[model samples]
Target: MTRDEFMGRLRRGLVGLPTRTAAEIAADYGQHFDDGAADGRTEAEVAEALGDPDRLARELRAEAGARRWDQEQNPAAAAGAIFGLIGLGAIDILILLPIVFPVFGAVIAMLMTGVGVFIAGGFALVVGPFFGGPGGVLAAILFGIGLMGLGLFMIGLMALLTKWLIDATVWYARLHYRVLKPALEPSNNRSQD
Candidate 1:
């Protein structure tokens, strides 16, 4: 491609960047074309030597992202960034699932047990009164019902808390890729060099 075509494509790919920043990048590439031409190379040769416009845009974005990553001091973001990089492929899944699930599974099991107890307590409250055959079992049944209600309330609270935690975990995982993107791009630069 000619210099104009290459610069146009680069500008398009970098639309998300600030106008001045994108213009600067385009100008730098334009200079590369000029320098190459002065050395008796065609525009296509300079563009090809520089690499694909799309990849360059991604790298630039990633670099910006990484810089932001440095500025933000979030522990969860750090963990997500690590996992995000690792979890791109199958090995991360293999490593993460085993590490993650055991704790989650155990917590779920204990929560379910609490719910089961509340249900059983409710059933007892319903049945114990009838089986007593019209004695002062009314008081006992009322007490049992109170206990069951309390249990039900606890379960609801637990459910809400668990949902919030799960939501946080999911959010962290999703942020992983964007955080890692900048870090990953620089490695490509090193390799290409």
Candidate 2:
């Protein structure tokens, strides 16, 4: 593809983006073509190196959404990021959805279990001395303490796991882009033919 064709396709694909944002992206890509020319590469070579304009636009949108979510940490931004990532391909629906849903369920269950245990511990601590003799009272206190500690540990572990899951999703998306980029390049298709 020529530089004009590549730019036109990219601009069309970026229709929903803010005008200034789209213009900046276009300028950046235009600079890429200029740099390629300086290195004695043709417009077609530069366009091929950039890969499909539509795919590139999708990636840029996803990346921008992710960045917005990271910065704002709001539900709308997060939803946008998620939808953007989902638009990248079928792997998310076919593979990630199955695994992520179960993992999310497990995390929620852990949280519930932690809260239940903590409440049970509080109940034991409060009612222990009323139930029996001194020995029983001491035993109750110890057991209550243990239960509360266990509950706190579970809650903390769940938090860590949640963070890890988020980090892994972001990492996997970036890895997917890197791994698929070469395959998407037009030069790769010509070489295969």
Candidate 3:
């Protein structure tokens, strides 16, 4: 597609953005086109350099949604951003989704097992007298208490693991923004040589 087509797609994708923010993005890309032309590049070459418009649109929309969510405290906007990106389509799906889901499943399974163990331990402690004499009952109760403690610890660890997963995903999103930020800038405006 040409620069005009790119801009049109970008504008539509950025509809959720504030008018000024959307216009600024369009202007930056338009400037990118003009600067390329001045440097003797063809429109097609510049558009090609800009990358696929449809995918670009999705990226821009997701980025805009993330920014809005951050600035305005909008949960719906945050959810929209996540859905729009869907692992950013940056990571290899075959590598990412399969690994991520199973890890997630394992964490959840661990959490469930922890809860189950804790419950069973409580039951055993309550029925300690059914085992044998007082010594046996005391031994059974102590074992149950140990199991309950271990289970609670495991559950807490799983909770931390779940939080870490989300934190890691957001880190990827931030990294994507960092990479794209420079690509969108005019060559002359870039910080690197």
Candidate 4:
């Protein structure tokens, strides 16, 4: 392909990627082409020497993916690995009674958690005015009870939501890993088979 056609294709393939990354790649290839042309090569010949657009894009993608994996795999790092995320999901479900009645509990937990958060927010809003009511002592008593229930509900709601999120992410990551592991680990292909 001509340089212009290759650049257009590359740009399309890199859609949604950061502009800086695309610009750097374009600049590098442009420089190489310029250098080669100066040494008595045609644009077509230069592109041919440079290699296939699809192959180059794939190489860059693999490099970027590798860097991402390395960053994630490093222990004592803030960013968690896919496996760690999976385990977190497992723990969230186990702690929040996710195993008892997966479908029913998840739905109920979501509803209850929403109610709890709403009630807690309501407490914050009414706490000030509640102190000035005619039956201030009685108001305070009721407010205290409401606050306690709100706190418990919020805690339970967050636990339930967290469990759902983790489980979904774990399942997604596992499926993705299954598809990618073979292509990525050629040495283990025979064993996997």
Q: Pick the candidate with the highest lDDT.
A: 2
Tens digits of per-residue lDDT for model 2, 31-118: 9999999999999999988888988988888787778767875557666666777777556468788888899799979988988898
Number of clashing pairs per prediction, in order: 0, 0, 0, 0
User: What is the TM-score of each predicted model, taking all chains together?
Assistant: 0.44, 0.61, 0.53, 0.38
TM accuracy, model 4: 0.38
Q: Candidate 4 at 115: error in angstroms?
A: 22
Better of 1 and 3 by lDDT: 3
Candidate 4 clashes between residue pairs 3 or more apart in a chain or in different chains: none
Query: What TM-score does structure 2 among the candidates reach?
Result: 0.61
- Residue-level lDDT of model 3, residues 1-193, one tens digit each, is 7877888877877776678977888898999999999999988988978876666766777677666655654447556656666734665445677777899899999999999988888877788658785678788889789889988998999977875665565566667667875765557545455
**What is the model-wide C-alpha lDDT for candidate 3?**
0.75
Candidate 4 residue runs with Cα over 4 Å from true position: 72-193
Q: By summed lDDT, which 10 consecutive residues of candidate 4 come out lowest?
A: 73-82
Locate the minimum summed-lDDT window of 10 residues in model 1. 78-87
> Which regions of candidate 3 fall more than 4 Å away from where they truly are?
1-84, 133-135, 180-193
* lDDT per model vs. reference: 0.65, 0.81, 0.75, 0.58
lDDT ranking, best first: 2, 3, 1, 4
Q: Write the per-residue lDDT of candidate 4 for residues 17-58, one digit (tens) a residue.
A: 458877888888888778977998878877876666755655
